[model samples]
Structures are given as C-alpha cells and as structure tokens.
Target: MKNNNNKLLNQETLCIHAGKAKGDHKGALTTPLYQTSTFVFDSAEQGAARFAGEEEGYIYTRLGNPTTRELELKVAALEKMEDAAATATGMAAVSGAVLSFVEAGDHVIVSHAIYGCSFALFSHQFKKFGIDVTFVDMANKEALTAALKPNTKLLFAETPINPNLVVLDLQMIGDFCQQHNILSVVDNTFLSPILQTPVDFGIDIIIHSATKFLNGHGDVVAGIIVSSKENIAVIKSTILKDIGGTISPHDAWLILRGLKTLSIRMERHCKSAQTVAEYLHQHPMVKEVFYPGLPSHQGHKYLNNQMRGAGGVIGFELNGDVNTGRKFINSMNLFSLAVSLGDAESLIQHPASMTHSPYTQEERLAAGISDGLIRVSIGLEHTDDIIADLAQAFAHIENVTGKA
Candidate 1:
C-alpha cells in the first residue's frame, strides 16, 4: 500500500490512504496504535544520535510517536503544509503556536470574534505575560491595518468565526501579514481542510481542534498545528515538548480513523446545514440567521470565494430574550443540548451562557453574540428531522411567550 501518487490523488482518496503504510507484521490496513511511552533504540550510539537530533527515531512519546506522526503527516498533507505537530487539545495547539513564536513585549492582532477560550487566551493569559493583543474586525481592511504595530508578530483569525459565523478574507489578510513579515495563523476548526484550505491563500499556520469535526465522533480530544517544516520544528522541539501538551498515541489513532470519512461527513454536514439554515430564516420567531450559506449573511460572499461549501454550524437569534433562548434550547428533542460542535449527532447550545461565558456581556455583544443568540451544529441527521426539531423548539419558545 505504498502511496506512490499521493500528490495526484483526490481529497477523498487522500483522506482514506494518505500517511498510511503497510505494516511490517501482518500488513495491517489501518495504522496501528503504538500506545507506548518510549521507544527503545538498537544501541547506545543510536540513542545518543536520536537524542541529539542527528537521526529520525522516536525516543519518547512526549517527543514523538508512530501513531501521532502518522496523524500529523495526514493532516499536514490535507492542509498542504510541509509538517505538523499534534497537541493534547485545540487550545494547546493555539497557545503552543503563539507561545512558540512570540516573547514578552511582542504584540498580536486577533479577530474581534473568536472562540471564547481563544479570546481568554489572548486577553487574560497572554496579557499577563506582557504580550499585548489587539482585537480588530478583520473584515474591515482599514481597521486591520490600523491595528498593526511595529512589534506585531502575528495576525490570528478564525473564518466563519465561532458562534457568529463571520468569515474573513484570507487572501487580503495573508497579503498584509506577508508585507509586514508577521505570521498569519488561522483556526481552521470550523471549516476543516475538507471545506477550506487556509494554506492555499498564503496562511502560514493552520490550527484545529481535532475534538470537533476531525474526530467527528466526539470521542477524542486533540489538536494539531500545520506549517512549514522550519516552524513545525521549532514547535515540536520547544513548545510541544517543553509545554507538555503532546497528544497521546491512542487519541492520535482515533483522529486518524476520523480523517478517513472526513470528506463524506463534511458533505453531509454542509448539505443538511444549508437546509436547516434556510428553514430558520423564514421562521416567524427567528430574528436573524448567521449561516454563511444564507445569501443574507454578511460573510456569504467571502465564503463563496474562499471555501468549497458553507459549513455545518448555524447561528440564529430568537425573537425574544435570554429566557426565550434558554426555553428553545431546553425544549429541543432531537438536537442534544451540548457545548461542542461537529459531531455525528445534532447539538444545540447557548453561547452567552456556555462556550462564550468567559467574555463580558459587552464583549460578547461586540463580537456579535447576543443574549438571544442560539447556535446549532447540524449533524448527519436527516434534514427534515433536524428542521422539525428546530421548529418544535421554536414552538416551545412561542408557547412560553404566549404567541403560539
């Protein structure tokens, strides 16, 4: 099963066969989970060489593992990067990538609306370490340009941004970063490599919470950073190793299995999500729909230009208040009330009280997260059933408000 023509293989084929090699024992089709803490060297001289970086043999699981390496290779190939590094969690990938490059007194410009944890990482954690960060509306080119400073080392963005689904212009931002010599880091967790490839538009680093769509099953918690070999080497040797955020070999294996079905899964997710978003748009109780697939969405044009399909996640606002939002989420039957997205099962969550609670009310509003906002991660469920569940939830809200 040698991958002689991997470069020429289509994405679906690459997902199934890339980074996989026949086993030495029984020719196992799947990559084996080398669930061990350390690998033994043939001799002391070989061990010394491995430790000194003169040879390419795994010494310890913390530094590297066969399963994790295979997963990294698969993701790097999918993202079209030179190399990649896996981490314990998505936040680990985020923090590791940023910390690996910047030091005290450096500045970073980040999108105004990102995942709550990412916002906290920049605002609270990074600030304490003397790393200044400016949150700007990346869609506004002038604002983004104004946010740049002499010490700015990175420009961070999340397309079809979390909860709000605000898409950014990758080429525009990538060019700015290139001109300024600043690293452009994108959290491609929402779109994944199946829908959008950030590296194609000149993005320098790509990050993902393999816990989401990458794992699809919602069983494994992992993250990965993809970049050029030089950048990955620094992160692998320093940030990933010293910070102790290396992903477990077993977890890496689970993510590897998930990658095989990524293409088909994403296709289903996109199709179903479009149906759901369209249904919500015409609902009387719905205030607004924030899916990029919807022509009315502010990011729709950018999504059309940069991505292959609109993603599965959709955000909408109830025509009422926070209590109405809670009632709708609580009344959902088919859609599970959960925190995370990109699962095989439909999930609904209220970001103001859940994922984005870390942000103050004003900050949340600034990021387009309103109290009445509700986000749904459309899963592999049939489109009709998902829409019916949402319709019933809206009915529940209507009943509570005496409008039914």
Candidate 2:
C-alpha cells in the first residue's frame, strides 16, 4: 500500500510493501489485477507512441501489464537486479534467457547436474535448431573454463541443482563468462533469491520458477527473468515476444501475494529441513544424507560460502534398492509423496522413480542420485511433528530391512 523507494527495505518489509502504490485506492493493501488483454490510450498519437515503444505504457497483456509489472518489479527487488520479465512457466524463462543471446550456430556451456527439463531443452531442443552445448561439472572451475569456446554465448548453471542438490561455483563461472563477454544465467528456484542471490556474484541473469518457492503454495505456475532493463528489452523483443510465453495477469497477482511471505516461509522450510536431515543422518537404516546444510555433506562448506543458510530440501539414501525407496515413500504417513518440491506441506519422493526417472541408471549415478535416495521438501509445519513422522517411517524401514 506504499510506494516505498527504500530499495534496501529488509526482505520482510519489501515482501509486504515493495510493489504497492500508496496514497491511492480506498486503503486496500493488496495489488489489484488489471485483467485486460489490451489497454485503451487517450489519443491516436499516444496509442501510436505506446505501440512504437516511444512512450512507456502497457499496450497488451502479452507484452506487459500492471499486475505482471508489480510481480516483476517485486522479484527484481528481491533478487537485487535492475529489472525483471515475467513468463508463462519456469522453462519459458530458461529458454528465453539463453536463447536471447544465442542462435542456431552459437554454443552454450551447461552443468551436467541440472533440472531434467532444462537439460532436455538445452541439449536436445536447442540442438534441433543447430545450437551447440557443452555439459560439464559447474563446480570445477578448470573444467568450466575449458568447456567454453570462442562462440559460446552463455554459461548456464543451477546451483544446488534440482532434486540431486549439486552446488556450482557461481563466482568462478561468473568471472569466466565476463572475460568472454558471455551471459551467466542461473536457475535460482531451489534456493530462491532470498536464501542465495546469484546476482550478487555477478551472474548476468537469474531465473526462478515462481510455481515453487515464490508461490510458496503450488496454486500458480509462472517463471521470471531478472536482469537490467537493457537485457529485458533484448530478450523479450525476440524469443519472448515471438514465442508468446507470457504469464497471465491473474497468475502474476497470485505470485505477488505469495511473495509477501517468502521470507517467512523459507525460514520455516529450511529450519524444518535441517531438523529432518539431522534425524536421517543419525538413523541406522539411512545409508547417506545429501542435504547441503549437514556438515558431513560434501558440499557443505561451498554451500556455506555461497548461500546464507542451507536450503529447504533434504536428500538421503536408504539401505535397500529402488523397491525400498518406493516402500519408504509409500509408508510415510504425515509427509505426502509427490514429485514437485517447495510447497507449504511436507512432501517426500524418490528421484529414481519420480522427478528424475527419465534419466538412465548411469545418468542418475553421475548426478550422485541413487535409486535408494529420497528427497523431502520440508514445509512450514511444526518441526517436532515432522520429525515424529519421519521417525515412524524410519522405524518401519529398519524393522523390515534391518538397516538405518
């Protein structure tokens, strides 16, 4: 409800007040959606200027709208970027961000461990259009530099990568891309900009699946690309406009409402995840735990350096094989077994059978995801209650398999 210019408003304050216009509207606080396909201008000259991009104004929902602008500006502020562009879905943001600078013959360097859909889009879909890609360990600075080419247009990565939770060296990747004048695009959905900001590390662009953390509830589907106004103009004018992947104004409004509590929700999720991860690590039937928060995790220190705190997902391996993993997920009482992550209710799933099932066995192994591994999207529920549910499930697992 306030036109707060305080760009440095604490995240909590920004969540509630960042995009609001005060001194207007009968004291209603929330953003009202301008649910229209096209806006009418005052005069023919004004309409011409709006269409010509000579004067800044919303002409069509497909190009931009007030509700969508509120959400985009809020996210841009959250990620500490100059501007942002809202899109139809997470993949749309990914494709639009990279394809903005790349073309049929240009090259891209990507991490091996990443969202399956993103991998498919870059390595498979882009290849169909003659775009080239080199996949390597994004954490390995030497390998990342070596993977680059004279024609490489983008250095793409997802830190604490989807499902498996691999951490990439954002600073190194950012530096290398800068030296080559290439864009560094990061998928910040897992950690959200609240937990870790890739932009601060010099990443050229940041992408988020608002369907996940930003929504904080699984009701809306959306994505966003946050960068400077210059980059937004370049990307949206081409791939985003021609492809026609824009988020509806209503969905944008929902995302804005959800963002008001992002800081509150994330703190709970990460805190719950830490509790559960510790329990899993100490359990006898648990062979291994893969949460970045745990000190024993291989990437714990790297995570500490990059993120403000450990994230909300906890990944662990069971004593048995794929069937055991399925049984563990099915036997859980309190935690729902689902494919998607970053919801308000706790969810558990086996990557081998659910989210990453499309990957071959070798591919899963390469990503450090095993058939016995389970991932939990910790929610904003009572920690002790969550731990109790996991404890009961582990007890059953150990009774049947005689392992922790």
Worst 10 residues of 2 by lDDT: 20-29
lDDT to native, each model: 0.90, 0.83
- Per-model TM values vs. the true structure: 0.98, 0.95
Per-residue error (Å), model 2, residue 83: 0.4
Query: What would the per-residue lDDT of candidate 1 be over residues 25-141, giving only the tens digit for each residue?
Result: 366767888999999889999999999989988899999888898888888888878889999999999998999999999999999899999999999999788999999989899
How close to the true structure is residue 179 of candidate 2, measured as C-alpha lDDT? 86
Per-residue error (Å), model 1, residue 163? 1.0
Clash tally for model 1: 0
Please give, for residues 1-404, the per-residue lDDT of candidate 2 as tens digits.
Answer: 35457475877887777766543556666678789999999999999998888998889899988889888888888888878899999989998998888888899888887777887787678868899999888777788778878888888888888777777778877788888898889999998888888987889999998889999888888899999999998987998899999999999999988998999888888888888889888887788888888888766887656897788988788778777777777778889888677888888887776777667788778767677878889988898889888888777777777774
Give lDDT for model 2.
Answer: 0.83
Residue 295 in candidate 2, Cα distance off native in Å: 1.0
